[model samples]
Target: MNTKSLTLRWNKRHWVLLTSLLLVLCLVMPQWASAHAYVVKASPEENELLVTAPQRLTLEFNESLQTAFYNIKITDPDGNQADDGNVQIDPQRPHILETGLRSGLGDGTYTVSWKAVSADGHPISGAYVFHIGEPSGSPAGLKDLASGSGAAGGPLKWIVSFTDWIQYLGLSVMLGILAFLLLRIAPASLQREPMDVPGSYKLLWISYGAASFAALVSLPLNTLYESGVDLNQFSWALIGSALKLTSFGQIWMLQMLIALLIAVTLLSGYDLDRTIRVRIWSSYGTLLLVLGWLLTHAMTGHPAAAEQRVLAVTMNFVHLVAAAFWIGALTAMAVCLPLLTNRLPAKVRGEIYWVTLRRFMAWGMGAVAVLVATGIYGSLVILPAPVLTSLFTTAYGLVLIGKIALLVVMLVFAGYHTKRAKAATGERLSRSLKAELAAGAIILALAAILTHLSPGQPASAGPYQGTETTEDGSVITLQVSPNVTGENQFEVSIKRADGSVVKDLEQVTLSLTHLDMDMGIYEITIPKNETGIYKADDYISMPGNWSIKVHALTRSLDALDAEFSIKAAKP
Candidate 1:
């Protein structure tokens, strides 16, 4: 065979080896990912509880849970559910679920059941029972706490957010480097005398091949972890299950495509076949890297709303391709720039670098435009006002803000470097570009941190207001109270439409519901000493919105029923 044919054969062999290695690596990483700490015990102890009623139920897990998804449920002997609205994670101790019990239960067995997904995406579920005597006659026809369900509160959300940031930053940097090489450095490397070292290109192909595998495997595993699936069960079967049910399918497919492209490129290079086949595969590999960005970032973005999901997917595809072209070019430049500066005539290398830089800048600008447009739309859709506030107020929010700040800093640095590189003479220009690369690394680190912070609920207020009324009469009244207080207290007075005091009502029963958790009935027994004014020493445990159901009963007959809501601002 001619030397040319021998080169082609060698490239083919190289491609096969890299592809196989990547495939194996993708299969093995999930085990390590799944081995993290999980929920091991609960105070109510998963379907087991004492006959004696306790004021609070405790949950103990093998690992400290992320505070995002903590909650619990209480079921009466009759199966009526009293949901305690919001279950908060105590700040002083991060693992504890802290909240207060509802009123009304009088002497009977009750069951407390719970299901939570941890910060790392593991689902923890169990039940326990306690007794509440004099059980307010099971509050006719109340909604069962079991009827309501939601994702668990904990750190998994922040983990997903942080991982996303890392994936994007890493992808951007890698692509930028590749783009630099293709547009600026590759031609320079080719023009020079070919190095005699055997399998030199193998190092690049292997590293990228490994990255492609990690990207593919990690994307799906991350998705599964977020969805509350058991990571320990990872296998071909599980992978197939996730592909069928999750948004991860698209990510997996993209990874596979990139892996294939990598294999083909390696093969072409090893075969010493610098024919159109090699160029085609290399270009395809680059294209796959670019497209991978959409599968990873764009679909989850803000602009993804009005446009159909398919359209979002398409736009993300374009966005990723553009980013890869930009970043990949940067990678290529970093590798070839030093060599070009050292070996070639200074004037000739400088001209080449300038032309390449201009090309990369155009592509980078396009990627930025896509990122901005899509990002804005995504924020509007996914981030609503209250969640955004959470992003800033909560731990997750602070990190995200920091990440954005760093990204802005990176862009500014890039602009400065671009200007300096254009005007500088000799080594000064090279130094400036190198400094810009270092700055990019810092930005990537910030991106990683941002991913760890919670996307949090956007900031909003006034979703609730306070009001009061007599259950039987046609009197409506608004009460003004202090904005902040440690003790939960509210003043109330009622009058008829004619401004006469509502003296006919004998008693008012207050049933408070926290979020969905029912805090039974608190009967406001009016003492003869207090006249028409009724008061109780009972106080709520925390500050927030509490739905009050007021029932007016006269003698044995049902007089009337009325509903009023109030917001308890933090004191």
Candidate 2:
């Protein structure tokens, strides 16, 4: 049993994997509409031409957004800051984001650029162009506005992805190795005379260092990424806002606190092989702390946004624990095996090795079972009805396919190890162990990327439509896209009963009032363009019955007010 044969080191090949992961992060991100928070509706819609400068700019996302880091701005044709620098969102209606514009500016084409974190903590950003009076601007000008706005893509995304990988690796190794030491190594060493203070503890200490450092850096990195602030803009003020204003900030705090406790628990004389009582306390204590830490991680991602949050979070936590207990423990065991070959004799070491392997296999199988069950449930959570067919079509699905292939390779290697358990000191056994660990590394890498990607969502429903026939034999119809409780696209089309477009109207207004409550009336003068269609982006604000009134003023000063009713849906 040569120790050198069992060793694995970071060489050029591994660095290539890191580079590949970063490339994956950059290349597959553009088409990510179902990701964290994407623009569902923008006032003065994409590529729209406005008759006049809008007083304010508004954006509506499919989900609630974090206000602390909300960055929405309008830049003029010359790349001037045209927005009033006030991003506003009601705590009760975060989906409807609004920001005021600087008053009365001559605009050619204006770029509306925005960056925001979703409720789930994923950062999202994009830019769109709309013109006032006419369309006049180069793509380069809009690109300049997008760049000057400090959106959080580029190198920052790669850094964030790398940090995520390190965090997952460190936590899994730290906990999984500690569990293996107490549950497997300690029992055997206790049976014999007290063994030498081994290098396994040293390995555990290194893992703790990685995990603690990752926990510390993750907070600020998250703040920067979410706030769309670059390195030059980094400050304690930004970090403070994240901590104070959002649920994500609170979860980050909890994760940091748990990391500290885990460090203290390790340094405060709690050794795995100390005694039966110490082992029991250390095992149970560490397990609880790790669960608390993982629970906070679960609280930050897709679960927080899920309808069945408690259940989704619980399943995510369970999935992580099982993965640590199995794949992570295997990685720990492989690394420790080399050190063991140097310390213990052939007969005694072989007995302990085989015993530990046999014992772990039983528990590991249970962990595997749990992993299978939760993996299925997680997929279900990611892709629900109407989009379940995307299981083989999405980027998330491609990552899933990669994970399944790697997992099958790992299980095959594990079975080989089981068959060779009695004579596991050979180079074949060492090769098998390395193969299994290599598979783990790739799977974990994919898993890190998978977490950042969108869990598939159902395709959005179409707009609500209605038509009214005026007494003068004219027809007016209105359509509202995905008419949920947030911002809605209200479109009006008018024509004669003979199907000729109406040209008699001087001005048209759509007045909306909540029928259930006297919340006041909202009258927006929907602008009509050359296409003969009128459009206005406005907030529905709440659920239930609503009144829609179309007031059209004739060129001769006559007015026609047609009333219609609609039911608005919840967000």
* Best-matching candidate per TM-score: 2
lDDT winner: 2
Estimate, for each residue in 353-417, the C-alpha lDDT of model 1 and write its tens digit: 55445444545555555544443443333332454554454343555466456557546755764
Instruction: Write candidate 2's Cα lDDT for 1-571 as tens digits.
Output: 3221221121224434544553454333222123355555667666567798989887777678777777787888887889999888866788878889998889587877777777777776666667898666433544333321112354566676677677667767766776666555334552332222255467666766776687778778877777777789999998899899877688878887887777666654345447756655655566578768766766766767665667667777888777766766776567765565446675576665665565555556556666666776676546533345556545566678789788888878877776565355544255677678778777777777776665442122346899888898888898987775556788888887799987667778987776543334656685545666888765554444579999877678877667888756433
Off by over 4 Å in 2: 1-34, 49-53, 76-81, 105-108, 137-140, 143-152, 184-197, 246-248, 269-279, 337-345, 348-351, 383-393, 422-428, 455-571
- List the global CA lDDT of all models: 0.46, 0.66
- What is the lDDT for 433 in model 1? 55
- Cα lDDT of candidate 1 equals 0.46
